[model samples]
Target: MIVDPAARRADGESVRIAKDVLCAGATVRLCLPDGPEEWAKALAKRGERRPVVVGDDRALLRVVSLLHRERDLAGSVLSMVPVGGAVSLARSLGVPTGAVAAARAVLDGAERRMDLLVDDSDGVVLGGLTIPPLRDGRGAARPASPPAHPWLSTCRSLVRGFTARPARAAAPDDAAPTRLRVEADGVTLADLDHPVAGVSVGPAARTGYARVEVHPALTAPGTAPPPSPLHADARTVTVTGADFRYRADAVVTGPVRRRTWAVRAGAWGLALPPRP
Candidate 1:
């Protein structure tokens, strides 16, 4: 098992629980790295033994990113025992949220294929990606936060309050709504002429496709209402606009003028709990 240092720092007890369960349930090699370099080195040398990441979504993404860089992602079967405050992506991917349950799933689960979105710069998104990347809905209105371990949730809140990036203040001359042109497959869903509140792209319900959605900017009082929001399932999604930011797999990135993402169906394998 490759244990992330951040996971150990955030919730050592949960890490201990996952480790104990994994050790007792199967023949495993524990890799307790002192830092990021060592942690990556451990994974690099993790030959033959199933690589079970004991950490949050970030660590899982790190693992996937590293493996993808090495061109070893497709042939490897991966498992994760969610152990930190930010394991929402792991939970969404069907890994058990509890330490014991997740570790147990790692031991007894079967591998399942999952879709991936690969971007122009070779970045990967295992979960949804948002244009503005707002976590709290950017207003008084917002969605409830995902559930997480009580203590881990507290820990994450404390850490985030200190380390999270400050929200970007809007600049003068900037458009009230983001102005971008979005395309799915070859059809245009949005364009620079029409401002958009936001855009998001990710795996769709249908296999071998991605769901691309463009949210229209709220109607101005005197202007005709913007076209209704557009959405479609496509093999590829492209966006071109002024510098913009995006959040993928819970990490914020980019101020790029253009970005394109293509769906790679069944690109990797993840372990899920055994069927009932």
Candidate 2:
């Protein structure tokens, strides 16, 4: 089991529960790596043992990334027990939210293939990516706040009030939306002249394509909303415009002028609890 330091810091109870459950099921080797480099080494030495990540989305991504770089991703089956400050990615992939349940799943689950998005820079996206709605000339509006934890909702709210990024002041004039050229499978989704409010790309229901959506900024009261957020499913999604930032799963990245992510069908595998 590979335990992330951030997971320990964010929710030790969940981490403990996962460990206890996993240990009870089978012989286990606990890997407590302090940082990414150590984490890579731990995974490298995993040998035949199935690598089970005991942390949040970022932790899981790290393992996937390292394995991909080693050319071992397609053949490796991974298990995960989500325990962290952010678990949306894990939850979205159908992993149980409860520590005991997740750990139990890890022990008895079946391996299932999942699709992935590999970008130009070789980074992967297991969940999804989004370009937040532009707010005037100022930087993009902070991505929507993560949903509060159900049981610890109140605590999260209190914590966020103290930690939230200060809101940017409104610009002196009505700033134009960011002008971006978005394409899916080489088909134009959004033209550059008209600024767009947001764009999202994710694994689609179909096996080998990504669902892309481009939402144009709301126009004046009378004008039609720029052709209802363009939507499509494609094997590749590309965005080109001025330097912009985007959120991929839990991490925010990019100021790049262009990025293209291609769908890699069944590029990765996950060990998930059997249905029914």
Candidate 3:
């Protein structure tokens, strides 16, 4: 079993539970590495043992990345005993949240194939990806010296409420709509001529594709944005045209002007609780 340093530091109880459970049922080997180099060495040394990760999303990502680089991801079945503050990736992949339950699953579960989103850079996103808007977009679009002030803001809210469109996802204070050209399966979804509020991409269950959603920038107050934030599913998604950053699962990556992620059907195997 590999225990992430953060997990050991943040939630010792969960780590203890996982260790105890695994030790009771199997011949468990404990690996406590201090840094990335040591962690890689530990994983590299696991010759034939089915590695069980005891940590959160980042920890899992690290393991998958290592295996993928080694070209062994398709053949390896991974067991995870998530023990940290953010286990959203694990939960999304059908892993139990409770330490005891997840530990038990590690020993009792069956190996299941899982889809993955892999970028051109070999980065993996187990949960989802989000590209928040650039903050300056709103300022650029703001009408200068409007006398209505608060009234305009109120009217925009009212119109949005009555329109029955999906509520706009909140972004960070600094986020602003950016001009990006987005494409999926060779089809253009958004062009650089228009700024976009945000973009989200994630694996679509059993569909062999990833769901892509892009929110358009609202230029004028009390008016609905044109094209109503496109949504689609595709085997490949590409974003280009401007230097942009995105959050993949819990980790943020890039400021690169272009990136493409392709769905790898059953790219990795995850040990999940066996069905009844």
Which predicted model would earn the best lDDT?
2
Check candidate 2 and list the clashing pairs. Answer: none
Across 190-246, the per-residue lDDT of candidate 1 in tens digits comes to 888877888888779998899888989864757877677788999989888888888
TM-score for all predictions? 0.82, 0.84, 0.84
Give me candidate 3's TM-score against the actual structure: 0.84
Clashes of 1: 0
The ten-residue window of minimal lDDT in model 1 covers: 133-142
Number of backbone collisions per candidate = 0, 0, 6
Clashing pairs in 1: none
Q: After aligning candidate 3 to the native by TM-score, how far in Å is the CA of 264 from where it should be?
A: 0.7
| lDDT preference between candidates 1 and 3, better one | 3
Q: 1-276 in candidate 3: lDDT tens per residue?
A: 999999989999889988988899999899998888887898789888888999998899999988888888887889999888888788988999888899899899999887889999988887789998765543344455654789887888788799877756554585656889999998988889888888999877555799999888866657764567798889999999677899998788878899999999988998899987
Higher-scoring candidate on lDDT, 2 or 3: 2
Those runs of model 1 whose alpha carbons end farther than 4 Å from true positions after fitting are 133-175, 222-226
Residue 87, model 2: lDDT of 88
